[model samples]
Target: MPQITFLLPDGGTQTLEAGDAPTVMHLAIRHDLPGMPAECGGQLACATCMVDVPEDWRGRVPEASPDERDMIEDRIGSLPEGRRLCCQIAVTPALDGLVVRIPERQG
Candidate 1:
């Protein structure tokens, strides 16, 4: 299992122990953390799972898929370089201690 740290908008952190299967959105919802809506249940159609990857780890993560990129640009607001759909990020041992920042707002 890998541990993930979510930095919430309120300056609080939620640590979750997630196996290498569930997406970050699933982990957040499972732990009842705020800021992640996961409204479409991990589907890229929704922007409710949008998050910002930490600056230091920006390029470390894979580039967003075409579908994810399109969805982010169309459904979500402007896409920052590190912005990603949480549903598209799979939990993995390599992602242990991954840090994600929840955006202040979601549509």
Candidate 2:
């Protein structure tokens, strides 16, 4: 199992085992993590599941699709170099020990 770590906005940290779920949103929801709302239920339709992939892991992860990028641009207005929608991320073996930061708000 891949170990995924989440750095919450409150300066708290959470780690969990990444199982069969393809997206981080699924893992967050499964574990009842508070930082991610995932309003669109792992769909690219919502930006509420945004997470900041740490610099070291960013290049290892997949890039956002054009539609996901548009949503981030439209909803967030500003995109950080590490910005990512958790719904679009798959929990892969290569992502083991991945660290992510949860934004304060996803609105």
Candidate 3:
């Protein structure tokens, strides 16, 4: 299982052990983590599942896809540096101890 740390805008953190679904969005939704709407249901069509991976943790995770890149460029208030669509990333052991920050607001 990958242990992920989610940092909220309010200066709080929630750590979870995730292994079932592949994406971070799935993990958040599974735990009913506050603010994880996943309105698009893992589709790149929505920006509601944006999360920011820390600079140090970036290499441990996969880079965004071309579609995801376009979404970030197109959507307002999209995730900033190190931001990624949770739906676009999968759960992997390499991401263990990953720390990601949720934007104050998402699509």
Candidate 4:
């Protein structure tokens, strides 16, 4: 199993052990972590799963697909270069101990 750590805007953290199958958004929802609504159920059409990949881990996560890229740019609040939709990130053993930051707001 891989471990993921979500750093909430309020300075809280939620860590979970997940297998290499679930998407990051699914992991968040499964653990009942705050800040990721995943309103579109992992579809690229919604950006509710937006989160910022920590600077050091930016290039470690997979690149966003075109559709996800466009949707994120249009709907997420201000973000850094590595911001991405969590739903598009597939959990993997390599992502063990992966860390992501929840933005202050998402719309």
Give the top-scoring candidate (TM-score).
2
User: What's the TM-score of each model vs. the native?
Assistant: 0.90, 0.94, 0.91, 0.91
Tens digit per residue, CA lDDT, model 4, 1-107: 89999999799998888854479999888877877788889867779888989879988898888787788767754445888999999998889889999888776
Clashing pairs in 4: none
Q: Give the TM-score of candidate 2.
A: 0.94
RMSD of each: 1.4, 1.0, 1.6, 1.7
lDDT at 34, model 2:
80
The lDDT leader among the candidates is 2
Model 4 has an lDDT value of: 0.84
lDDT of 3 by residue, 8-98 (tens): 8688899999878788899988888777778889878877788888889888788888889789768864446798889898998888898
Q: Each candidate: what lDDT?
A: 0.83, 0.87, 0.83, 0.84
Residue 29 of model 3, lDDT score: 89
What TM-score does prediction 3 earn?
0.91
Question: Mind sharing the TM-score for model 1?
Answer: 0.90
The order by descending lDDT is: 2, 4, 3, 1
Q: Is candidate 1 or candidate 3 better by lDDT?
A: 3
